[model samples]
Target chain A: MTSFVGPELTNPRAERVKAVRALSGRSMRQRTGRYLVEGPQAVREVVRFASVHELYVTAAAADRYSDVISDAHERGLPVHLASDEVVAAMSPDAQGLVAVANVSSATLDDVLASRPTLVAILASVRDPGNAGAVIRAADAAGADAVVLTLESVDVHNPKTIRATAGSLFHLPVVTGIALDTVTDALRAAGLAVLAADGSGAHDLDDLLDVAGPAGAGDRSAAPDLAAPTAWVFGNEAWGLPAHELELADAVVRVPIRGQAESLNLATAAAVCLYASARAQR
Target chain B: MTSFVGPELTNPRAERVKAVRALSGRSMRQRTGRYLVEGPQAVREVVRFASVHELYVTAAAADRYSDVISDAHERGLPVHLASDEVVAAMSPDAQGLVAVANVSSATLDDVLASRPTLVAILASVRDPGNAGAVIRAADAAGADAVVLTLESVDVHNPKTIRATAGSLFHLPVVTGIALDTVTDALRAAGLAVLAADGSGAHDLDDLLDVAGPAGAGDRSAAPDLAAPTAWVFGNEAWGLPAHELELADAVVRVPIRGQAESLNLATAAAVCLYASARAQR
Candidate 1:
């Protein structure tokens, strides 16, 4: 954490303000190796768990979320109390609280070393909101880690961070790996690789029926939930291509009892993750 | 469906185009009793299922989505081919296809008459995307219908319609009803009203363990899945208040094995609905 604590920043057009605001763009974020964490909830999480370069808060926001500022101070992080206009200028949607965090430190190797029982893998998921929702759902399902394929949306996107509801800081999120590499690594790590797709032989309900000890009643060839598993979710629009779908040991579809062409990516991911969580229990 | 077919609309500022664009706002929709449906997927579904007032498209779009146009023509709906500028002026997100449809014909009483085995109730949900996602998830789970309390986001919001991914046309959506009335009506219809809250007394997994005939283990007082049930989800930010929580017969919580505070409204709704769908199977 930077120790550049200073008096109240009253100038909205200050170079520091412009620098922080620039992080909202992809090129600026890459050049500075920093990303914007907006609003009180996300800013709080970053302050507590990530390497926050600086924290900007308005006096009103400072009073409202005192714990966040206090925690940041306790962690030896710079907490800048900026004017309302100055804070808003940095990021309009930040609610007067913003944090500049370094790029992620999480890697697939580190996550694999922990021997995760359940994992969520997003392959080419383009929607930031969808990706964030899946991460939050994965965390709720007690997943050990989440991996985003190379073609997926950037995990550091501000929209994705907001969508995670602070769960972004709760678990390891490995990004920028190829889909095939992710499937191979998770499988090699002794976890079954299951891809969530509309075209699949296994019905999720049937898998639930024979999962765990008491229900391991018969099907010898069925993918068993007794072992650790990783689920790969495809893009929000096109879904998994044949090659990507072929990477997993099995492709499973969440059954649609009604006439919906398909459930949106996030909801489908939630159902699949929760099912796996229940089965592995 | 109206038969107001005429020459291709060439002017972007035409009164017809202005009127179609105006339907995107709430007041215009209320005054005209019509809402805008954008994109080919939604336009197709509205044409097939709802009372579509008119259809607008560009020549290239009509060629790309010929089936949509053919179906609308067969249904005797007015099909207006507009220039690219005119179509874009009608609704930028429409991607060259747009439709104006009457407000929902779905009513709670009509839904009740069908003896719905499963239903989802949204209370004071402000986010249009969350409302639509819940509706879509409920439809995918085979829920008979969806109901939104009077305080919830308008289901006709273009964002909400798009979030539904066309599921809005697949099932009945009852809106503008109070939460208490919705609960009471569903309960009287022989369905157990369960409120999804983080402070619930019953764990969803524990309930699932004893659900269905095969696993009807012990737990006599636990809510059973053998009978019809209705789930009520609270707002996205502030969950159910004490008074609202008191309206349900029981409260059930989705187990959070990880550190997430709570699941997002839509994802949480999906988990609960799918669990019910699985158990009721």
Candidate 2:
């Protein structure tokens, strides 16, 4: 075991911690192409994803998570011992583990070139949790890609990343692509573009019924699950902006017969994405 | 305009603001049988629901909402001017209007005596938003009542109330009941108890299908719509406790073919509730 570091120590043995703290902001995250992970859960996920550029553990936590630390260390990942003060300063809810990893930063061209079948486009989603959940849902639905408009919350935001439950590391999520480009590219790919609208013309169940089973044996009867399709989700407050809705091949609403005015943005996105998955099944 | 003159304002005219601020907590809310409404939107909702005990608005907000305030006042409700300081102290996000309204508490007797067809039982749900959304969904699905387990978050929590989008005022939401009493009473009422589990033996869709349509012309094929049925949603953190699961007549799960472990609690509840509504429809 490494010699016990004094708990009160506050020397900068690693410059990466500072770099990571700076990445907390949107500008810094964009510039550095790095994102921060906080607490034991996120740290464990980062280790599983094995994309850790730098890892910081409090001396006490290091003792507790020696296995995780050693695994990352074996991969030549930089490991630093942070004083409790440092950890507290770095994480609002520090459960004694933190890590920073470079984001995948996949491009739209890369996603389109793959001839993706299932995809989700988020236009101006504001909540970090919703943004993260959409990406996570997109990943779960086996979407070939997730595209984000410029106005959407940064996927790398700590809250957003946490909400993804580490699926963000696995999913091919791309941001800053204009809605027009996405719509045209989807059209070019022969994929139907469906937007989730609060006041949509058709019921979501109807769309799913038409799409057929995601993994149905009867190819002719199925809506062709392998055929490229993009499910678009909008912001929680105002929903999909009208201009973006114009690009949709079909507008669908999740039939909410309930008194709840709206579902949480993330929940709505999940329902839509899952509907697509169920339909294509 | 009536002048405020409560403990909140040094000036006698600010008493109205003091009364509104006093309703922030449960004890005070119960004492006065009143609760505080925050934001212009919530005030509008309060007015629409016809439960506004008193209305308080800042000068600027009153100017913008003169029609709304005047209408409520013409209905013989008191409209008072709250200084900016009063509204700020009353509601952090006052958004220019606040209202003090009678607490619309629903009791078990109130729920059962109504002869509800569909009821949702919330078992220890801790998140305000989740609880509020569930209640709102219950309202949307036309559920007769929402029963909360003893440990569940307060339905009247501002965040939960706000999440309901004013459905709290409209919906018959009951809390502070023992699990056994509520479950047994529901059973006695001839309501089949269906609990939502993340990995239940039955899929939600399948359960809905098996239940058949409510009130179909063929009496043998479909259950009567007026027959009582209760759907149970568990806590957000740990989900339905094992013992609670055993109490349920049947367990149902929303199938997830994706990588996500589970849907958010509110989303899961909404889906299940909506599925039941759809089956009945």
Candidate 3:
């Protein structure tokens, strides 16, 4: 691994700093085909799973998290030490570490080609935090992939990446596709598309019961959770439109057993995905 | 209902505006025994369930949400029409509406006095957003009350209130009590105290299985969810301490079904509470 024996980058206005900062914006990210992953956990994940073009760390942070730097260097990725100000200027939420990764764009065909048993399709979900949390939940549920429709929030937004808590690297995340295309592709892959909404007729628990035992052992009498399925979540404020719901095979709701009117998008996703995971297991 | 015929509050420096704005801080809230509830949803809940000292709305919002204003007026609460600038200065998140509500304080005795069937006890959970989400989840699960220990985040915090999405008013939220006191009181009330932690020995689903069917039909052999139960959640970062976990009747873990290491605090609470809600139902 080649080591840099140069002084730490102190100039916040340096071309390198400006370029890294530019990744925070949509136009620049699109033009450069690179995005920034901030904080130690996200940076480590990007280094491990994706092609990280550059790694930046504060001098003190370099000492604190030497393993990640050395690991990145071992992979022939350059590690640059920068002043805290430079790091802050690049991304205020970096917490002393950042990485510039090549935008690993995946298409509907790329994700569907894997024959995913379980997938999460988000339609017009505008909240970046909610979108990222859903991605994290899907990863935790061992979903094969996550599909964000063209109308959904940009997955490359730093807020979304941070909210994913590094799960963005655990599985394939396909974005910028039409919802109809996603539903059709999943159906073509032999997966049932279930839309999750509060107003749905079928309750999630009832659906789980119909999906048979939590384990994959008994699948003769009832539909198995092991069956390939895709869960489509809609926008936070206004859930799946009538057209979107019509595209799904079934619509399911997480029953509110109490005074609460409904569950937030992320929490609902977690419950739905975990239910499927438990059944499949 | 009394009609507010006074000139619209146009001065941002008005005493009424300053008093309402002061409620945003913890010290001011404590001193005045009042807290600010912003946005339409939360303001409506505070008006319905809690005591509102004063209601402020932009002229447009007054016309837009006449139902809430008229309802508040019907309940003998004064509604004041203010300019957009005044409402904005009071709280940027008001969305043209805000309410100054008398802080409704409840104790462990007050909560347990009601013979709560299901309770959520938060121990030292400091993040306002997480705490609020937990409260909302508890409400959705139909829990009777939420107990926040002295070390937990203040329930009166505006961020916490906003995060609750009006669930804060749907149920009694008791705060600033000792964890030991809460545990003892819950146990005395014949409620099983279950601490939720990732490192726990018992899997949550297994516990649910032992808790009998999702419905309350067969309660002879298993510990039915209809029986009184209290769930104790710990801090966000460290989770429950050994001593805190020891206070519980059982420690439960939501099994990690996939590669993601752990679920966030709010999502975990949602899953746990909903599991109980489903079982009880």
Best by lDDT: 1
Pairs in steric clash, model 1 = none
Q: Per-residue lDDT for B1-281 in model 2, tens only? A: 53333322324235655666778777887787777788876677678764778776787888887766866766677776756776787788887788877766689888888987789999988888788877877776678789888998876668887888777766677888888788888888877777888768777655544555444434343333223579888887788888998887767788765556666776677667766665665
Q: Which runs of model 3 end up more than 4 angstroms from their true locations? A: A5-7, A213-226, B213-227
Expressed as tens digits, the lDDT of each residue in B169-245 for candidate 1 is 89999999999999999999989889999999999999888787654433348888656899999999999999999
Instruction: Please give me the DockQ of candidate 3 compared with the native complex.
Output: 0.68
Q: State in Å the error of residue A242, model 3.
A: 1.6
Best by DockQ: 1
Candidate 3 per-residue C-alpha lDDT over B159-237 given as tens digits, one digit per residue, 9 for 90 to 100? 9998898999889999889999989988988887889888877787776666644644443333455567898998977
Model 1 chain B lDDT-worst window of ten? B211-220
Which candidate leads the pack in TM-score?
1
The fraction of correct interface contacts reproduced by each prediction comes to 0.87, 0.33, 0.66
Q: Candidates ranked by DockQ, best first?
A: 1, 3, 2
TM-score of 3: 0.93
DockQ preference between candidates 1 and 2, better one: 1
Q: Write the per-residue lDDT of candidate 3 for residues A1-281, one digit (tens) a residue.
A: 33654678999999989989999999998999999999888898888888788888997888888888888988988888789999999998988999999988777787878888889999999998889889988987789899999988989999999888888888889999899998998988888788889878778887676664463444333334557889999998898989999998778888887778888888898888888877666
The per-residue C-alpha lDDT of model 2 at residue B171 equals 65
